[model samples]
Target: MTNPRADRVRDVAKLAQRSARTRRGLFLAEGPQAVREALRLDARLADDGAPRLVAEVYASAACLERYPELDALARATGALRTATDDVLAAMADTVSPQGILAVCRQLDVTLAEVLSRGPRLVAVLCRVQDPGNAGTILRAADSAGADAVVFTEGSVDPYNPKTVRSTAGSLFHVPFVIGADPAELAQQLRGAGVGVLAADGYGPVDLDALQDESAARRLTVGPPVVGPLGDGTLGDRALGGGANGEAAPEGRSSGEGEAAPSYALEAPTAWLFGNEAQGLSDAELALADARVAVPLYGEAESLNVGTAATVCLYASARAQRRGQRTG
Candidate 1:
């Protein structure tokens, strides 16, 4: 019934590309748990029963021997493709193909979805190209209890195979959103009452200065947003942007509000982090209502983007939890 590219990596990639993987722009997850996540998203969740999964059913004996369980899981999950192992192998992406793979649809989310969620915190990533960094940032967003992870125009794709692997399981739990135009995201955040903040490698105010006291937050930055992109929204300040998009204050922003105010976590807030090496540009810095920086000790220069993002997100979470208990 199939072209039967069994035991072939190229064919596997191709078949998968043309099948659900392409229609939904998703990739194959090799591990059992990974497939389970896909099933969960599709409403095939079973807390204790044998988890249904997706896989090529008519595999060669060798392929079946390699991943016998995948067949059962596929049948359970209703993702079975009755094709020879050769065909299945043709459509996969692994070097030494794992007999099991689950198809996932890439999330096509927008900024407006983030606004409607009623979030209290958000994280924004800007031009963080490293897939590892992108994945770590997503994990941090979940750990920090962010409502959403937002990406800017030039950030790395969260669905990039390496990136998906890097996220571990956090990839499935987060509500991510992607936006092509920074200006459009800005308008959405404003309407949602999310105040955007920029992270500076050497800004005047401390990172702890971003705790807020109002509506839910929204964040934006990077290319494809990841994590909880629910009530909050996130975005990046144009790298090298100036105060009001001018100069001088480009490294940071000085405006009407108190430059370094810290509030409860329940206070709505969105925080933006910049590129890996170059940091946020002047124009980008100008876009934020305020600029935040990690309180450095030695002469280390600066923290890695992932490290900085984690710290900021965790801080917001901590404050928010504290507020919840107190309130």
Candidate 2:
């Protein structure tokens, strides 16, 4: 492992290529920040009955000394190995290595598995091509307490190196799905009692309006029956996310209320954000229960998709958290 030209270094370096990543079913997480998160999550996810994501950790002596957590994790998992600085640099995609990197299996879960948790908030990146945008959105989703993120077909690969770097370890914090069908995913979410909202600059529904309405409705008595937004996609009369269609407060309900309080953003929600340049197609927008727009107050033309997603996801997260406490 000391030699930079070793076969292990070459193979690990090859992961920068998508083809190589796909062939090997593994991706490289460069730098200590990314690698540390992977190690932490590997054990945490396992506790939740999900497979461990981190398979191996290669680090320079400096990194292990600088971060004792890494040393402890390696001792526990038996996956840590010391490497020369040159070896780490060879395995990293960045010009300056962070003294460590991780080899982790691509962490993807089935759509059914994700929905079975009855997630309160979710983000769907539809046809977003930029790796940086995708990674930033993942970070935003994690920060907003989104349960999971979905990368629809034509969206950037969730495991891309640039995307991983931009995530700053949030990638390991939140679960994500790749290559999902936008239409099918929408239908599935609707079926699970989650409302699907599409993010569009020209969307008819104002995000602020939805928040105001949600706040105003917090004290209502009857559980709101969620229906289709006349988009001809989801059926009417469906209750928002809950166990067995009953109002479960969190993913698991404790019989807190007879019926769940429903708000536009309080209900189990999946937000669809389109490509950075073209935005969502007509059909893509139509798949949502409603199309929501973040109103721009400044003279700026439009917000970038990453920024828009952050605003939208946080709005939903705030509403959902408040609803949970109230319930």
Candidate 3:
């Protein structure tokens, strides 16, 4: 533990690479926050008769003293190793590991496993290549109390060191499924009674209007108010208008003698967030039941994927929880 160049230090450092992590079925959780969360999850899983998540933990004496809880949790895993600052740095992915790091088993669950949970809200990342954006979205999903976050096949590796660091310990807090095929995943989610929505800037449905409609439903007593579209439902008004309240372009109007697709905001839902640059592809967008756009009131051209995702997920969270309370 004292030697910075020891084989054990090098082995843990190898987790910084995707190939090594894949081969060993482990990833590095750097910094005190990440390490602490990992240890806590390990303990929880152990209580369920599950295998330990933390294969090993390396910490400097100062770090253990600074965070006694971390020391206790790490020791509970029976994998804690006291190491010099130099050795701890050698084993970490960050420039500074915040005095501690843990080698945790890959925590991704199968798509079937996630679906079995009857999740009310889920976030799906499609071809998102940025580590920071992916991690931030996962963190946002966790904050919104999303049931799970799914990473499409082409999305960035959720286990990447930068991505793990960006989560700020949220990686341990949220359930995630990786390498899912967008089309198949969409089908499965819908089959599970979950509505799949794509977050597109040019989407026909305005997210704000959906929130308003949800709020209105919650405030109503007997029957819902009949909008001008005359379906006795707000779906047409909410879906047939653009973010600016303008009528949807030709062929996209839900008010034209057709049943407006009923996408109740309070329903079980999964949101698909696309890549930072190109956004959702046509095929990917097609997998969703509806495309939703987050409104931008200011001069800002667009919202970052993370910010947009936060808005969308929290929207669903609020609507779902409120619906539950009322029901």
List model 1 lDDT by residue over 149-223, tens digit each.
887878887766666666765777778886445556655675676666667644544443333322223332223
Q: lDDT (CA) for every model shown?
A: 0.58, 0.77, 0.81
Looking at candidate 2, the ten consecutive residues that score lowest on lDDT are: 241-250
State, as a TM-score between 0 and 1, how close model 1 is to the true structure. Answer: 0.68
Off by over 4 Å in 2: 45-51, 224-263
Off by over 4 Å in 3: 221-262
Query: In terms of lDDT, which candidate is stronger, 1 or 2?
Result: 2
Off by over 4 Å in 1: 1-24, 44-73, 81-99, 208-266
Candidate 3 C-alpha lDDT tens digits along 176-228: 99999999998899888888888876665667777887888888786532211
**Top-scoring candidate (TM-score):** 3
TM-score of each: 0.68, 0.85, 0.89
Displacement of residue 73 (Cα, Å) in model 3 is 1.0
- Poorest 10 consecutive residues by lDDT, candidate 3: 241-250
> lDDT value for candidate 3?
0.81
Check candidate 2 and list the clashing pairs.
none
